[model samples]
Target: MKAIVLEKAGGPENLHVAEVTKPCIKENEVLVAVKAISLNPADVKPKYEDEMLSMMYGKERPVILGWDIAGTVTEVGSAVTNFEVGDKVFGMVNFPGIGNAYAEFVAAPEAHLAVMPSNVSFTEAAATTLAALTALQILSGKINKGDKVLIQAGSGGVGHFAIQIAKNFGAYVITTASAKNKDFVLSIGADEAIDYHTQKFEEILSDIDFVLDTQGGKVLENSAKVLKNGGAIITTVAPDLPEGVKAAAEKENKTITNILVHSSAEDMNTLKRMLESGAIKPNIYKTFAFEAMADAHREVEKGRTVGKVIVTI
Candidate 1:
């Protein structure tokens, strides 16, 4: 089997395609012949940091990085009954840990896998897993029609999905992006697009019901100012609340919380319904061959990609 392998955390130069052993599955897992994988900013950062890799991937040599995958189930475990050998499935496998998806095959737990919507292609389904799930989980149980929601970096993978998901819940989506992607973000359902380079979002926007922060640091901190009293923020980029955000939120009677996305079959199936109904659409900015994993990483690292970047096997 061929897989993209890495040793030590570093740059794109550390990623290499090599022949490796195929993975075996436990009774609760299914073996998928991977057809597509999505590249994300998260995928790049952890691989370049030793501490993160050790904590996330468990100090494994020849670490395989990636979580989003769409493929067909070629083999099913003895305990699995919801799927068979020929099922087409996609999901974010074992998030907050190694998924080992950047390869020709993935051993995913049966519960983590969802049946792929017939109307969706493998590439599109592959791109939908991690980013879409992050967006979905972040917004769940917190939105109502006509609520004001701000999603930062609206052109990036999670941001794009967040915009569409926010819109589906009837929220008024406000987003931040560069001048070049302002229209693109709006076209994807953001009711308002703030030019981050030319405008300060915190200064102009206020009374938000919910904030989804993808860019950490200043962006996450500033978002605190706009929330209405009793509102809440969900941030994925930052490990903890920005230095003073918690205090400010407390003062204003608002809430700020950090999130790490987890894989859920239920969420993926909900997205599948959205995909089939045209309620939400995935924006795949680019797709690369499996051999070009390094190139895909480089593009995602640029922070300018307008949607999901896919690597196809």
Candidate 2:
């Protein structure tokens, strides 16, 4: 199998293509011939930071860095009942752990995958796994119909999905993006788009029932200000709230918490249905060939991609 192996933790240049042994499947896992992979900020971080590299793979040198994958099952584990050799499957495999998805093949837990919908392409299915799952998990039980919801960084990977998911739940979705991306965000279902460069979101928006804060630091703190008293804010970026932000939340009787997206077949099925029905659509900013994984990382590191960046095998 061909894989992009990380030679060292420094930059995209460290990601080099090499021939590697194919992975073997566990009793509950399936061997998939990877067709497409999605890039996330998580994938980009480990490339430049040893700390993040150790956290994700734990001293494994020449590690394969990826999780979001869409592919066809080539072999199923003995205990895998839900999938067969020919089934098309997709998911964020072993998230917060080793996924080894930036390759021609991957060993995915059967429980982590959902059968890709017939209406969704491999690239689109791959794009939805991590980012869509994060959005679905964050807002599933937290949002209600007609509530005002704010999704920060609405043009990024997770933000784009959050906007559509919030709207599907009948929430009045508001999003923050640069002026150039304002129309793009609105087209994807955001009821209102705040130009983050010019307007302060807290000043223009108020009483937001829920907030999905993708950007941390000042953005997370500012997002708290716009929430209605007793409302909640879920941040995917900030692991811990600053003392001042915590104090403000406490004073307002609001909830502030950090979230890391995990793998879920059930949630993947929900996303599968949404994709099938066109309830939510993936806005792919670009797709790179498998050999161009390094270039793909460079594009994502720019922090300006409007939506998901994909790599096709």
Candidate achieving the largest TM-score: 2
Among all windows of ten consecutive residues in candidate 1, which has the lowest summed lDDT? 237-246
Model 1 off-target regions past 4 Å? 239-245
Query: Poorest 10 consecutive residues of model 2 by lDDT?
Result: 237-246
Q: What TM-score, over all chains together, does every model reach? A: 0.97, 0.98
Q: Number of clashing pairs, model 1?
A: 0
Model 1 accuracy (lDDT, Cα): 0.90
- Model 2 clashing residue pairs (backbone): none
Clashing pairs in 1: none
lDDT for 210 in candidate 1 is 96
lDDT of 2 by residue, 4-51 (tens): 999778999888999999998999999999999999999998678888
Give candidate 2 misplaced runs (Cα > 4 Å). none
Taking the tens digit of each residue's C-alpha lDDT, what string does model 1 give over 197-252?
99999999999999999877878888888999988888886636655768778988
